[model samples]
Structure formats: C-alpha cells, structure tokens
Target: MSDDELRELVHRVDLRIERLDARFDALEKRMASVEGRIESLERTMTTRFEGLETRINTKASNWVVSLWGATLAVLIPLLTLWW
Candidate 1:
C-alpha cells in the first residue's frame, strides 16, 4: 500500500483504540457503582435479620419465665395442702 494509505489506516486504528479505552473506563465505573449498591443492600438485610432474631429471642425468654412462674404457683399450693 502507498505510504499515505498506511498512515490513514494507522490513524483509524488509533481512534478505535481510544474509543475502546473510553468504553472500558465507563464500564469500570458502572461496575463499581453496582458493587456499592450490593454492599449497601447486604448491610440493610443484616440489620433487619438481627432485629428479627432479637424479637424471637425475647419472645422465647418471656414464655420460659411464664412457664416457671406457673409451675411454682401450682407446686407451692399442693405442698401446703399436704402439710
């Protein structure tokens, strides 16, 4: 090919490479944004799960206390009647 044609080809290739680089940079920025969003969602979910667990544990503890109080009340009355 003539020198002029070769130069034109090289210039076209350079422009294509520059466009590809810009696209890659933009894609990297978008990926970072998605990652940040995912991390935020994970933190929110973790906090909600912790709150649910605390509620469940509190309910279970209340049930146990009530059961113990009822048992003692019944047992004490029976013992006094026997004595």
Candidate 2:
C-alpha cells in the first residue's frame, strides 16, 4: 500500500530466495557425492565379476584337457592288447 511496506516485502522475498538457493546448492553437492560412491561401487563389482569369469574359463579348459588325456590313455592300452 505504501512504498516502505512494498520495499519491506521485497526484501523479505529476496531473503527467502537466497535461503532457498543455499539449500538447493547443498542438496546438489550431496547428490554428487552419492553418485561418485555409486560409480566406485560399480567399478569394484565389475572387476570382481571379471576375475570370477576368468577363473571359470581356466577351470573349464583344464577339465577338457584332462578328459582327453584320460580317454587316450585307456584307448591305447586296449588297442595294444587287441593287437
């Protein structure tokens, strides 16, 4: 209604806006920290899974080689006895 009252209202609104901005900035910082932690966890899990896959592949190869060796050892003796 008066110029002084209008000015006071504007000042109060400005203060509220500043406070809201500060809160948003703080929330943004916290979100960034949480995102960083999540990325780090994903990298660690990826490394662990890759290691497990390598171990499984190595074991499978070893089993295949052992199976072939055993089959040949048995076949050779039978062939020699028959001949």
* Shift in Å, residue 37, candidate 1: 0.6
TM-score of 1: 0.86
Index of the highest-TM-score prediction: 1
**Native-to-model Cα distance after best TM-score fit, residue 52 in candidate 2, in Å:** 0.8
* Residue 46, candidate 2: C-alpha displacement in angstroms: 1.6
**C-alpha RMSD of candidate 1:** 1.4
- Model 1 residue runs over 4 Å out of place are none
Cα TM-score per model: 0.86, 0.85
CA-lDDT, candidates in order? 1.00, 1.00
Could you give candidate 1's per-residue lDDT for residues 25-76 as a string of tens digits?
9999999999999999999999999999999999999999999999999999
* lDDT for each residue of candidate 2 in 1-83, tens digit (9 for 90 to 100): 89999999999999999999999999999999999999999999999999999999999999999999999999999999999
Deviation (Å) of 48 in candidate 2: 0.7
Residue pairs with clashing backbones, model 2: none
Candidate 2 segments whose C-alpha is farther than 4 A from its true place:
none
